[model samples]
Target: MRFKPLPADFYLNNTVEVARQLLGKTIVRNYGKKILAGKIVETEAYIDKIDPASHSHPGITKRNKPMFEKGGIAYIYFIYGNYYCFNIVTERKGKGCAVLIRAAEPIEGIEYMKKNRGKTKSVYELTNGPAKLCLSFGIDSKFNSISLRSSKLYIAEGKDENFDIVTAKRVGITRGTEFEYRFYIKNNPFVSKSK
Candidate 1:
């Protein structure tokens, strides 16, 4: 099958649905002369303000404004004041929901990723964690609210990602890591260390 990006509706409907659908897709970031892209292997969903652990529960702000936008846009935010976390806004306009890209396995632009990361021995460090992947690819707060189909940081089909998706509890959350919202490829070595 050809790699066709799902419509904006695919992400604007629900966070969990968007998360599940993103299991085998590709995330591409075009940085000037190079395009750093990869196959998505891990993700977690944030449903609504009542979810207890969602970022929007505390009310929207200049920082989380991207999440309230229409879906299919990047909502990159910094966590822990140092880690850059990547998220995709979900639901129609005004919904403060999104799917967090927990981790990814590099599938394209190897040398570029390596150069950006300044390492070559291990591929895991290139894109294993959300913050690590963003840093390697130049994704930052400036990319927030950008279209998911933009020429700069859009997502597209890269390679075939057919397989059974595995579901598990999320990690690194203070209140809701037990909801089983994490989704990843079953038995895929590149899924993540915890998988």
Candidate 2:
């Protein structure tokens, strides 16, 4: 199927708004000869200096340089020395804001996702978290700083459906926890956590 990536302008909005609007969108990974995709179910916004939990809070460095790029690019980072978390850069360049793709519902290439995740008990467990979603989609540091407008990966439109969105505080962070920047589709089983 022909999938068009969201325009660069789509991610130039406020980080929190971009995070909320990402729900129900599809993240596509062009893996080799196969195509893997999922409907975005959860996201978390991290704003520059305003968010102490943001990697760019300490100012741009080699590791977080991708987060400082213009919007509509990938800002993948490794965590706990085990897994990679995928994020989409948002707002203008130097703003250092991004939207973390927390979870996604498997929408295409289920077999590929199952094999990548390895030994998952069910489909719900395949891409229910940021790390799992990255593993299942084969996303890593190599994808960081790449333009999402075109390449091996991109975010596309999902099936037409309306759903309620739930806003909650960002998780897995010790600082800036008071900001309600996390957003997810209400009652989505694939959401990593519900508030």
Candidate 3:
């Protein structure tokens, strides 16, 4: 069954723990009269200066200001000059920690996602990567710093009963590549570039 949107307190935990706990959460996007939802299957943690892969590693800037906010806010950013990536601020305010939502299994509004992504091949193609998921859900830089508890976009609880989660080195990065911060559901086909 679908759950109510998560509260801001739900994100006020350690960065890594938040990433792990988000494994089965449902990310909901309320666009107009339609609802776009997906079950989070993969995530990666960026912990302050300790994690060189994090944008806030060098301290807060205009672009990464949202990362310095309290947990439960969006930190959407543009990359490759072509796609936008979505991240959720984690930990307490001024922690500069966040969790990158790497992938998710499409659940609701599959048709809307398919149309947004211009994809019709398979469900997996709808949200198999950070940028891809944002594209599929119509998220962009404009969403940066928005409250996750808002009705427009929020994360809801899910069937996090017993899904096996595996941790591995984060992908598509050069610095801080040795940290095994990436977490994904074991055997989940929706994971982005899983091993």
Q: Which is the leading candidate under TM-score?
A: 2
Candidate 3, 66-89: lDDT as tens digits? 999999999998898899999999
| Candidate 2 per-residue C-alpha lDDT over 1-195 given as tens digits, one digit per residue, 9 for 90 to 100 | 577778779999998889988999999998999999899999999999988999999999999998888899999998999999999999998899999999999988999999998899699999999999999999999998899877699999777899999889888999999998999998989999634
Where model 2 places Cα greater than 4 Å from the true spot, the runs are none
Error of 3 at 11 (Å): 1.0
- The TM-scores, one per candidate, come to 0.91, 0.97, 0.96
> What's the lDDT for residue 7 in model 3?
70
Question: Worst ten-residue run, lDDT, model 3?
Answer: 1-10
Which residue pairs collide, candidate 1? Answer: 12-91
The candidate with the higher TM-score, 1 or 2, is 2
The Cα local distance difference test for each model comes to 0.80, 0.91, 0.90
- Compared with the true structure, model 2 gives a TM-score of 0.97
Candidate ordering by lDDT (highest first): 2, 3, 1
Between which residue pairs do clashes occur in model 3? none
Count clashing residue pairs per candidate: 1, 0, 0
User: What shift in Å separates residue 45 of candidate 3 from its native position after superposition?
Assistant: 0.2
